[model samples]
Target: MRAELPLAAVLLTVVACQSPTAEATAGPSGVVTWAASADRMGDGIAGRSYRLVVHTSVGGTDLRIRLSNAFGDRPITFDSVYAGIQQEGAELRPGSNRRLAFGGERTVTVPAGSTVWSDPLPGRLPAATDLVVSLHSPDAGGPASGHWMALQQSYATQGDHTAEESGAAWTVPTGSWFYLDAVSVHVPAGTGAVAALGDSITDGWQSTTDLNRRWPDYLARRLQRADTAVKGVANEGIAGNKVLADNPAQSALNRLERDVLSQPGVGTVFLFQGVNDIKAHTGVTAEDLIDGYREIVERVHTAGKCVVGATVGPFKGWHEWDPAAEAVRQEVNAFIRTSGAFDAVTDFDRILRSPYDPARMLPALDGGDHIHPNDKGMQAMADAVDLTALDCDTIG
Candidate 1:
């Protein structure tokens, strides 16, 4: 935690920082190589410098990052920013650290409820690499925006140490990714990307931290090795997020444009949400969830993209599991499989469920929570995705 500073001290006005007029200037042509769904993080800290570590999917030249202040009530200025390759812990690979500028300036202020992308850095980033982004906010507070459950350890410190490649200055370890939301690279002209819009399962819950074992991570590795044009995978998943309602994390439907459609080179959207809404018992029936899926598919198609719907994985052993919810899940899964509303379908329930007990997760795949999957289960889910189905040719 940051030193306890008065709210007034951190809430410096935009004029005080001498920030430029904030706008989301369009970035260079590229594909999103990595992404994490953003939500309302706790209040920002004054003089907090964050060294956020993000894993790359499909790497290419001219790397860029998107910083978000989507939930802030006032403008926030990022005075200094740097990108580098992680060598160990908080240390960067020497000579790989490079300064990043926003619209040709070393600093950029992002207004409330907006996101800004930095100009592309000249370099070729390989696949499955750990890319590090270090930044400092001189004066920041109010509602901060970030990805909540990173499942990857990051570093932080006070003051502007954005240019440091040594881990000596960064002594604090944190799990959440602050400000940075997405990373992109210019790939082959025809190459495209896919966004996995899901909940905790897709958010990598129960998987080992710092080791990218999330299902989407596995899928990314597969895309790199296989002969698929859709090589980029963006995990736009938030824990406890739902398809119908918003709370701590915005609902999938509400955040669709920002998290998925708006991302660069997105050709496919994999929908894997609904367990939260179904188990919460918020008077949401199979029909209600089905309607939500229809809307997502329709909207994605309207954006000239393809949509892949996954059946809700079985969770009979979870604390919230009940016969009523199971019935709704079954009905929803049935619709997802046979209705043909989606551009394609992945039967996650069929893949993760125990053969002996239709409604229970396989013991080997269970992450102890019954709802989330272990590392092996995450691999299984990724293996079940047909790489060919991600092609955007299916789009109407």
Candidate 2:
């Protein structure tokens, strides 16, 4: 649903001027049940049709999708767009596939650094179903707006096959999602969502692909089953992302509004970041990272949302970990636990660290990478979340 933002949020709406941040990220009247943080991919292609398969968290009618050209140097046009249920690889469930329109037009162009949402398609979607969004961009090029590490494999073809239910023509398989960023469903009144903002761990790096096993995915399932007001989940993580600096992708601080607060029905933000900044040996002190956390809490509060802070997990054997970084992690975790800066805290460090060696990750949960968590670790992180903390209005 279209949410009204305070005048100060004007600066945060980096999308097109005509489209407000709230409407672009959240549907006009529904909560964003699924979203992927958008970043610049290699480049867009003309006549490229993508059949992206994404799992839903909450069920509702009138589903909508948001397409972006946020990083393009020039305007891009999408000639045809369709949404359907995925039957299998590059194949759609017959008769479930339907067309999507933007402002009553079949064709729409999104300017550089902007996004657009499709008119809600009429139908009911069940929770946990695989929803496929297929679209063909007639004239697409320049730095494409997409997520680089989807971890889930989707399909692509050379021509406009968006309207077809067959998978015969969709030959290319891709690991990243292009253009399509956010999806929403018209949920019951007062249904809120939680957006997880972090780095690779939250981005589902070590999690199983296409299985929806990211920590956020597990949290989504939890929210769906619980009697809480929050049922939607948005994963706003990026690999190699930092909290205070913009390099691999925009820093968590920089993209907070567009990726988190702008999503409709989002009442809480889960902040689990900082390892990259510490382990990178950037001379960032514990105080520095704490300030970043404080700023995030303050901003989220200002936006009328609660913040849930997570302690940085141990990474003793990672290539970049060092004594100094470990010290910083401990100090930061101390502040997160005792400072009360956040409305709530999730002790991921306490949950994932080895009892024998606090600096190292527990062997069973280490996904072969000392820095990233395994599937079990991801589930543990999600299970550790206090679901009640996700709905600020209800909790308050």
* Per-model lDDT: 0.89, 0.86
**Predicted candidate 2 versus true structure: per-residue lDDT over 293-378, tens digit per residue:** 99999999999899989999999999998898999999999999999898888999999999999999999999998989999999
Off by over 4 Å in 2: 1-27
| Root-mean-square deviation (CA) per prediction | 7.6, 6.3
Model 1 lDDT, full chain set = 0.89
